[model samples]
Target: MSHTLPTDIRLHKKSRTLELIYGDINYELTAEYLRVHSPSAEVRGHGIGNGVLQTGKQLVGIKGIQPAGNYALKIIFDDGHDSGLFTWEYLLDLCQNHDQHWQDYLQQLQDAGASRNDGMIARG
Candidate 1:
């Protein structure tokens, strides 16, 4: 949970990708991931007490990151899931939980009888 500061940051807008260098570790963040892992209560829910599943975000992309405050960032998603304010801690959480969380999301979608043929939702 202790993350080093990023020494370098790069954004490929055309590809909706963000690359960061922190000490010896490098990270690649897709706009899609940022959009789905938005820090909004609408996304994470209140204090982790709720289980709101996010679907139909396979094609969602981050339009931009709006400054929310000194500690949080407002992420704008192309799919209109732009209400989330992602903090550095939250972003780190997303990175750490990426694999498990993504699998859970996929399973949730499958349970709901959904498919990603459209690739319009994040479920794919």
Candidate 2:
């Protein structure tokens, strides 16, 4: 499958969002969403079914983004996480499936009794 690279990328520091433009389609992804869904081993783990749940990243912001060769981007987060290399294909997937992915994440957090806020867990 071929993935079209974004024609434009913008970081909105004040809004804590990253915007990507692919022709007529535009997508804005929050920093917290990107951080939690990072394609890094630390977040995705080394094997299937071993992914880690990321919490306390509600206020995370993008520090910067750098190109990884010709196919991917290295995203830097304000919380000092800079390991993930997001490929154009992966970014497109995230943008296209944003709603479902986000809802799944929220459900996972709920199941784990976790909160988005730092160091907070809901008790019930």
Q: Pick the candidate with the highest TM-score.
A: 2
Give the Å shift of residue 113 in candidate 1: 1.9
TM-score of each: 0.72, 0.95
Q: Model 1 segments beyond 4 Å from truth?
A: 1-5, 46-49, 117-124
lDDT of each: 0.66, 0.93
Question: What is the per-residue lDDT of model 2 for residues 72-93, given as tens digits with 9 covering 90 to 100?
Answer: 9999999999999999999999
Which residue segments of model 2 deviate by more than 4 Å?
1-3
Give the clashing pairs for model 2.
Answer: none
For candidate 1, list the clashing residue pairs, or say none: 56-121, 56-122, 57-121, 57-122, 58-121, 58-122
